[model samples]
Target: MSIIQINLTIAQMLDYTMPILFAALCGVLSESAGVVNIGLDGIMRFGAFFGLLGAFFSHSPWIGLLFGIAIGCLVGALHAFITIRWNGDQTVSGVAINVIAVGLMTYLLEYVFSTTGYSPQIQNYFGAQAYRVHLPFLAKIPLLGAFSNLSFMIWFGFICTVLMHVLLYHTVLGLRIRTCGENPKAATTLGINVFRIRWFAVIVGAALAGIGGATLSISSFSGFSDSMPNGVGFIGLAAMIFGKWTPFGALGAALLFGTGQIVQSIIAVTGIAPKLAPGLTLILPYVLTLAVLAGFVGKSIAPAADGLPYYKEQR
Candidate 1:
């Protein structure tokens, strides 16, 4: 309704968009390199759970963040091993990872903390409020300055997007990764180790998703919960698809979905139609995902060999 309110909404949108941004970037990287990572939800859940566990034990949120990243790498390697080394079905591997993660997190939460829904509030370090970025000079800039209060995760997400773009576009590693996805046989002929390249891409993607998950428990909120991600990882997949597998494109899709979330909150607060707000808010992202995909599905494309198991021909 006003300039201040709109700017504040956009600022909040940036924070809310971080999980999607990170996860979508992960999806883009993995899929661009010919691996389908439907397990985004699983590792995000792992990151949230383990991140809290690490902080709780060591009294350091930074350590928690590292734990999350490590788990992501392990999971990515496992997935890559299953698909790349073993030549297993990629979809089945991804789905299995998600299912395993759900069970693992559920069991750990109950057994370790004696809780079913969430973990105990992490303390001494992580229990502290997630840090925010405040630019002294920028904070004085009127309407836009209100946004300076966003979580540090929001800034991290933006930086990652730029970095991913550079990695996928400018680097020699980027070229090899793309070549592997497009034609592993050709890449192999060109002296690239196709399997290793795919493995590296998958691990890097998972590390990004780990940050996405950690943002939930360590940066956006104080502790982890069974439902910490709440479908943000899946939504990020949709964002990646909507973006046609590019970092900036995925970022735009994340912003669009984030706006939908912000609008949902606005509806509840504004009371334009109080009774319909909550349900509509809950369904907004899903509806948008389906609608956008349906509209653009025909035009959107994937890497030539995405989700296919690659096996080097015997000499």
Candidate 2:
């Protein structure tokens, strides 16, 4: 392909990768602190609609972003309460959240916006030319040209990746969180509040998932659709597994998935989708995710206490 084409493809890959990256990051954070959050997708859905609602009503995407994060925290807290506090089944709680999100969001869409398909188009930062960061000097630099003009979230995603890596590896808090995941009993003996750490992880992770959802409605598109996340959250979990639960690993996995998505789109645009069956073409990203998981999930090891409920009293 030509240089321009390569640049455009790279840019599109980053655009598509943002949500999955955020979701994977969410999974990494939660699981690293001994919580399994299968409801990341549901949290994204909640963030998507609420983010749009805030942006639509306030005419400011920033407010919408906050709305998404707030809802994510609330839902994350619910998950933490059930699993960490009450020692409920983490998987079941996650599944319940997903079910509730689907039904509730559909109902809210119809009730609030009078449409079940999608919300009305709103002023969004994602698509506006004014919101993009333009670096004209970088435009002619081959692969780097992709960075010439891009959404702020795209940059933020990369920054978050670095920050997460620092948080998980270079900081004392990171060490403590990892310790909680590996051995909550040990963490407790060291004066660390296991429940509190898990709570913080889940809530922050969910907030990031909320941002991922907002990226869909406000960054990648102008409004929220019934299928806002469209399985991106689950794919993110796949990315998390494939990445072995590391921030930079998640970033790489997300980019790989994003590449699959962009390739599918390119096939469609290049008149190859019809010849190859459009349905099959659309499944490329998922197929890639499964393939990666099949090869990596078995080899990857999780934290020792991950998904286990710790009752301090038992200790």
Candidate 3:
């Protein structure tokens, strides 16, 4: 391919990477804190629905973002209450969230809009908004210019990645959280409230995951659809695992996965092995996920107490 085409592909890959990256970070945050959050899809649904609702009514995307985060946190809190406070099975709780989200969001959509699949389009400042940000200077650069323009949420996702890395590795709260995940009994002895820490992590993680969903409906496309999330949540979890549960690592994995998803489109447009590309693109990420897990199973160890209930007297 030509340099121009390569740059365009990179830009497109980045466009798709934001949502997955944000969602994967949710998994990283949850698992790192000893809770399993497989319900990112559910949380994202809440975000997309509420975000569109807020934006549609107010014609302001910023307000829509707030709504998304709020709803995501609510779902995350519910998940936390089930798994942390009730000492429920984390995986079961997560699965329940996903099921509930699908059913609830679908029913609510039909009720509110009298339509089943998607909501009415939201109006915005750009006359109908495209969820992209085109930077001036970088837009003029040569080979690197393609990297400059992107969805605003992509930049937000990048910022979140940096902040998450700092929060997990550098901050006192992060250290406490890691201790809670690794050895809750020890953390409790050190005066850390394991329950609260887990709750905080789950809630924050959910909110972050909401950004992933909002990216779909608001930042990438300007409306909410029942199927907008489209399994990206599950993909995010696989990315988290493949990245060894680190923020920077998850970013890399997400980029790879995003590229895989966009491959079919690229080849279709470029007319490069159109027949084989479709099949390969569809199965690529999953194949990579399985391969990564198989190759790294013993090498990639999770937090010691991950997914384990932390009862005060467990030790």
Q: Is candidate 1 or candidate 3 better by TM-score?
A: 3
Question: Cα deviation in Å at residue 244, candidate 3?
Answer: 0.5
Model 2 misplacement above 4 A: 269-274, 278-298
lDDT, residue 173, candidate 1: 95
Which candidate achieves the best lDDT against the true structure? 2
Residue pairs with backbone overlap in model 3: none
Q: Which tens-of-lDDT digit does each residue in 197-271 have in candidate 3?
A: 999999999998887887778876778888968898888888898788899989998999999889887877788
User: How high is the CA lDDT of each candidate model?
Assistant: 0.82, 0.89, 0.84
True-vs-predicted CA distance for residue 231, candidate 2, Å? 1.0
Q: 58-158, model 2: which lDDT tens digit per residue? A: 88888988999999999999999999889999999999999999999999999999987978998656657777889999988889998999988899899
Q: Among all windows of ten consecutive residues in candidate 3, which has the lowest summed lDDT?
A: 123-132
TM-scores of the candidates are 0.91, 0.93, 0.93
Ten-residue stretch with the least lDDT total in model 1: 123-132
User: What is the Cα root-mean-square deviation between model 2 and the actual structure?
Assistant: 2.1
Collision count for each candidate, in order: 0, 0, 0
Better of 1 and 3 by lDDT: 3
